[model samples]
Target: MPTRLLLAFALLLASLGVRAAAISYVDEVQPILTQKCVACHTCYDAPCQLNLGSGEGALRGASKQLVYDGTRTEAQATTRLYYDAHGEAAWRRRDFHSVLDAQGGQAALIARMLELGRSNPLPANAKLPEDLDIAITRSNTCPLPGEFAEYASKNPHGGMPFAVTGLTDGEYATLTQWLQQGAPVQEQALTPTAAELSQVEAWERFLNAPGARENLVSRWIYEHLFLAHLYIEGGDQRHFFQMVRSRTPSGQPIDPIATRRPNDDPGTTFYYRLWPIQGVIVHKTHITYPIGSKQLERVRQLFFASDWTVDAVPGYGAQRRANPFETFAAIPAQARYQFMLDNAEYFVRTFIRGPVCRGQIATDVIRDNFWALFQDPAHDLYITNAEYREQATPLLAMPGQFDDIGDLLGLWRNYRDKRNEYEDLRRDTYAAAPLPGWSTIWTGNDNALLSIFRQHDSASVRKGLLGEIPQTIWLLDYPLLERTYYQLVVNFDVFGNVSHQAQTRLYFDLIRNGAEVNFLRLLPAESRQAYLDDWYQDSGKLKMWLDYTHVDHRTPSALYLPGPDAKRSFAGQLLSRYASLDARPDPINRCSNGRCYREGLKAEQRDVEQRLSRLASRPAAGLKVIEQMPEATMVRVEFADGSREVYSLLRNRAHSNVAFMLGEELRYQPGLDTLTLYPEVLSSYPNFLFNLKASEVEDFVGQMQQVSDAKGFEAITQHWGIRRSHPQFWFYFHDLDARIRETQPIEAGVLDMNRYENL
Candidate 1:
């Protein structure tokens, strides 16, 4: 009897040991995953769609299709081995009773694998719970509990998404655990979440807000972006397109923010007079077509022509002023005038598309219609173009003795008086309850500035004081044409300089905002022109005007949008046209427009014919043709000893412009007006060149990597804004030659030449 009892005890102990062994992760299961799964499940590219190498990937796969039964026979009972799109293993519960019985048996083993997979860290601030039950309850949901929904409720315009199925329930629970534990990231933080994703959608809606006067924040953002647009157009005042609209502060409810329609034109009034001005400042300028003659004339008369005069005034009292029109002509730089002509021409050509031979007639008619570009010195140009003049009339008159730069004496006084008057309105004992649209008037306070800074780092300003809705440019200074989107600069110290690092962070934010992508995909191709183009178009050309009181304007107002379809269509047409022009065939005779004009009759005719032939051939090309070249295909390194080492393109597949060496030596080759690189080496060494300027080098490393063979030539650009000092960086170049080479001849020679792609 004693022997039998001892045998029973031994059997019980052995059973418990086997059970524990079956459920263990480190001792029992990880070895299986390492041997069978790690081989193909590593890195971003997971073959067989299995990324078992990373912990997160492993758990994510828990609810995915996997081979549960060793036998691959049709007759064998197959299991629902993987999670569904929503990360739920609901199918598993239905098919495998043993798997669902977590209290004991095989269910326990399955639970152990899942728990082990949960060890991976989630993204920063990602909501995670320690209790498995809580995680399960919260998993497979979108808008993530209270956050995004709460945000949406506050801002009626916040269009947030509610459902997200990017990960599985099990993966989310595991991610939550890691996140709640402070996300002990082994590599990078967790991926985007449903709530964060909703925020992105909300951002888009907010970005698309009407830029009408009614929308104050949107207007401020637009004005800031206009600065970038001006940079691209050139700093010339003639080319600057300024949009000016003013309204009483919100509390005064007498004239609602949206009610001050300048010109009655439906187009202009849509954004200017009404609450929809917010949309104008944000998304409307992106709604472009060929330049409108009426609008251009208004802008030109207000800004460009010398002959134009302010009310009751001769030219500037101190200076010997010439007739605005005659003086403009005497400037003798036909290049400027020709740009004006071309802008008007393109506008008419695009809008009035019947006969090619009628260009002279069209030019004559349009020129005559927009004659304000020449300006008559006799009349009060200010009255005719009051819409634009008011934008920057320096609210306070100059005391004549004050210098214009930095501080125009009368300006501050005017601003102060205006502030005092606005303050008095708030104190009105019987001020009516603020109108709904009143909230749109944006006053640049710290909170408003901070909000904008948090959302965007770049903004636009008008060329003069006023033009159209304030236009803002986002994501400037890239190797390619930066997309123009609505954004606002929240802060700028006096000199208008943002650190390069901060600027980069801003760009990162812009990209994350996704407005750049939307604008690029939607804006007209011509909109891609650099600051020089923006300047040229705006300077002295009268095809579009900053009309304050036109009845036929097409710009949308705060009260109404042209509707999504209209906005999209308008934006799409402009972008398509611009894209067409960008890809247009290069002119055979590459001379300045002035020279081509001077060559006269025969030359102009020939050039026109050639352009026509090319236009006919491609049928699809952008208007402005600028060439972009790829980086380099090879690099030859000559060491101090004079022995040269050459790294040639091995596979024409992933060639780039810049090559980073292990420590400090940056190997670069400039060919065909583009930069090319060798293999970039990343390492840590105190004395190495790499370490000295690691931050600078780090900023450009990603750009260098982008130079694979597939994309040869990309545009190089610098940030142009008040906040950024416009630090120049080589575009389409491989290495930072300034650091390694003394002469720095590459920039001087290449400045005028078109950067070409490496073929």
Candidate 2:
């Protein structure tokens, strides 16, 4: 064919509404799904197990099995993408049905869903219709190809990107065309740059050095960082890797040893290999950890430079695997503590976001918001005294070491006894030494101070104390910190039976109380009991399990500060001490004495920000709407010039105590609730979105204040809320996503809309 004739033929094909070029799944299709679809379709709890975050996930398609089921009597088979099953045939045998038809005989199920959404676009700027159930607990109707037609006929609005805005015409056309052509996917393999390869080689050599000590250190590091998106400092920011235990050695193809837990035995000689992450980074699962020459040197100083010996490499026995102190006993306790403290935020996030994707059962063990302070390694008994570490090692056994349904009560009782013994030993150890004051708190690094916010089922951790003084403060020492990691991150089983899951949740209750009691011991002796009573006010029988009396109130304070409220005074002092390291003051939320401004704030912007900050005030009894507010709401302030700023309005729900696993509603104390305002989104999931013009800011605030009933709330949302039904939702979402990536590139990822409310 001649060039001119070929061009004429291509033009004819284009004129006939035929795509002359094949769609690039990597460049064209995946990006569309990431922005519009993946938010609700990623992670363990992805609706109907349809994870569109990767090509394999799409090919594997949807399943009716619920990953977040808490009622199962037996452990479910793990179906993790890329790990549990290899290819489409394997997934099909595991009961997954394809959403895309490869033969192209029938319109693919996904194509049909998208068309149904387009044909019956949602009503604009209003609450979603009652028929469209968007609740997190709503039953999933995972229709296969044969059932999709009947499914769509009954529920016209039930489509891909369900209850949200339909895709743009261009996006829809591109996706439909690709599905029409058998949904062919041409995925490009991730190639590491020369620098990245060099770094990987260097790290692998360091981790796999020919020595038992080196092997033990590598095992410890891999267990702690298995979930991390590891990257070498000064390398490409987009490229990230996971440190996996592989049967094949370095330089060979990575044959990952897929175990339920990071510490599970590989059943063969294994090497630590860096596996490049080959999927879109979702905020809920992305945890970034940087390694470089400096980090490597630091590790050497912490583990190798110290005068310590690894008597023998530890086995992956259940008892040793469940106790880090036992497994890594040869490593200096101070070295281990310092390593974790260096990246406290990342470690905290590992347990908070790592184990279970949608974990209300696990998360309900904590208060809605709290400040976390670490005890200095110098003062921490477990770090400084080998005797204390030895005594606490055997007592540190955690639940889920064995996932047996019959052992539920037995495990709980056994753990409870060990916890009691450990508590007594801890109190005696502290009493034997002079009671330290604020000096006991860790101040070696910026990670010394942290703020943890539980946004309902999901949570976030940030360095440096944030927001107003929280209801509870945790003062963690070495043992407490290491146990937290072992119990939650290493031992938690997302696919475990109800018994295993319940035991994990129940055990964390003891950990939370122990940390809280540590903080209470620092307060005035008279005030210690009062604080515990208030924190555990309505706990009926659970108080026995909490064992609040174990707190040593007889110990006198070494330093005295004169104040009516000693707890508040101490927290304020701690906050001021680290204020220099606090994250840059959020322009919207940082207000004092009726003034609000950051270095770059304009006078007009400052005025609006100061006024908006008033919404952060503690809600009075009459502000009934505060009780109804979602966990997180992103408020966008649009200026007349079209420039806008986004802020998060967090509803910090108060509770008598987060003790009871169930009956969370009964524990809610709405009158004591408060709201926190931040300059940008602080949560991975935003429940509602409100867009207001700079001029309408006051009206928006006024209406929010006056809203007392659901009707009034609806009125406010009808006027200002960017409901999923809004035609411009994608525009707002894209803007928010771009802004986050621009401002916090390393930490930013696609915000999840799985919890986006119908209103």
Candidate 3:
């Protein structure tokens, strides 16, 4: 009887152990962490300096916040990520907080923050029955801790997921069960897959190619110098990468924040912020995520462009400046060069597409257009993103004999200031490009700069087509062209890769607030030019602006977004975002627009989807040109092997859609992502490039067939805005280079002699 009893007890103990084992880091705890926690906590500057990336990071704990620090007497803590590491060190929840103690040793802080909001009236003081002296407050968890008594009086459930929802019971149990069983990491973290490794290696090989390295070196120099005041066509007022739309402080109304726009376009914003940190000359290479165990460094020596001997920096009036580029430039020249050559992978990864000819312009189009090869700049014409006139004098007007509000003499007080400094800069730093000089009062009248791209042969037609293909001879420094090229080739992302479904989605961007129509024509031509010059610089703003305005504008009626009332504005339908509910419209209802618009969109969506459905999934082979218009406006196509026949974009689209979308825009069916000129748009291109005699029989059909390699013969069944489907689309660097090389006008030499792909 005793032995049987003992065996029963042993079996029960074993069952509990097995159940605990099931609640592991891999099987249970991590899933909860990944879904509920990691998104907000993973980046370089994790909130409160608390990194929850791994078990070790969570255990290492959260740093003491700057909000509680006695340095400044204000409640305004920085809303953004705290990047300055000196202010905080992560503190372990085990040592300072309650939940870890209750869990025996498992202080998964995430589970703790989450646990607070699970129960409704949050145990008296935002604490569990077990919580003792921990500083997590109950009164306004604006995420700051106060004295003990304050916990009972203020907002109790302020801990985490803040305004967002909390984890489910099963998720909570999995995490707690794992922690109770000693939160050990049950399995190994994933390594890079075979495909990922192969992709990285391919990019590395291309970047290290001799031409790619030299191109990178040149590019780094140009961005560092030129971005500050990249020449706008008319403005003496130079532009810098200044924040146009200021981030609204938390608790502030959203409409106030949305109203402000920047003075100038913020394109080339990344170029201004190249040297993000000062100490490390080699930047930490960031690849497409799952940043594995190994980290790579890029030799940042190429980024050093300025002669640092000069004093009185561009933006800082009286303050002395430190040149972050000094340590790298001080390195032995050979060593510096070798470093760049060795770390080609890092350079390639960071290389992004350039602003000019950004999206889908053909590389050989220049060869087909007015081809000209001008020589490289003799020496570096260093440009900086510095501004002037505003910074020449002190900000506050000083008293000179008389000081009154808006006094003329007081306003003019600082005119005498920095006069000599400005003179020296002009004399020494801004002197002639080939000779010694200082900062000149550049009024965009530097004739030498204009004459750079002005080739003797193409002098008459210089302005006719160019500024399409960027010229470095016109560039103060040409290497920037290469650097931008390499980065873009590696990734080539443009505009979040978001193709808008409706014109309503253009709010914030392209669309200003409450405007009936979003058009560039609304602004003056000069303003339009200014806007275009700096349009793509702020990727973050562009995406956020897109996402925020996307939902509000989805309904056909602009008045549909009924302010911030959660109940009315919220479309409760599952899987439907923003006014997608198919509720019947009531004439008496204040928001009838929502219901009506949703139904209309659904019907339209169905119609387009059905029209698209008529398309055969795969293209019929050997499609032949039966007939085409002599002017090349419309063409008739027929399949040779099969009876499949169709007319699509080549049938009904306008000149703008075909020329810009098909030719310039990168968004096209894989095989068809090449330029075949439309007659209307091709009037500008030199006629000598095309075989005009072969126009009647073989205008678009032959050209499209040749470019598509028989792949795009599949008539696009999908709609462009509604539900566009595409073939295996690729802008593969190697393949693109091959095509460009093959299609190069042999009659004319290369326009950009230093183009990395050609090299």
The model with the greatest lDDT is 2
Best-to-worst TM-score order:
2, 3, 1
Please list the Cα RMSD from the true structure of every candidate, rounded to 1 decimal place. 27.3, 3.4, 24.1
Cα displacement (angstroms), candidate 1, residue 582, comes to: 5.0
lDDT score for residue 397 of model 1: 20
lDDT of 1 by residue, 1-759 (tens): 354454354446545653211233333234333333332233211222233333334333322222221122222222211212212244335332221122422223223333333333232222223232221112221122123335334433212011100123433333323322322322122233344333323333443345332143333223323222111111221121222232332222112221111111122222211111110011101212112334334333433354322222122221111112221222212222233233322221122221111111111111100000111111122223333224323221212122243443243344334323322332231123221121221111211110000001111111111111111222111111111111111111111122311222222222222222222212222332332133224311231121001111221222221444433344233233333332211122122242311123353333332322221111011211112221122222333433322221111111111111111112111121111112221000000011112123323333433443323322212211000011111111212222222222211111101111112
Better of 1 and 3 by lDDT: 3
If ranked by lDDT, best first, what sequence of candidates would result? Answer: 2, 3, 1
What are the per-residue Cα lDDT tens digits for candidate 3 across 88-113? 13233222221222343334444455
Candidate 2 per-residue lDDT, tens place, 536-578, comes to: 8767346754443367879887757568887888876765676
By lDDT, the better pick of 2 and 3 is 2
Better of 1 and 3 by TM-score: 3
- Model 3 regions more than 4 Å off: 1-19, 43-48, 67-112, 121-154, 185-321, 324-380, 383-759
Q: Which prediction has the highest TM-score against the true structure?
A: 2
Candidate 1 lands at a TM-score of 0.18
Model 2 / residue 569 / CA error / Å: 0.7
lDDT at 54, model 3: 52
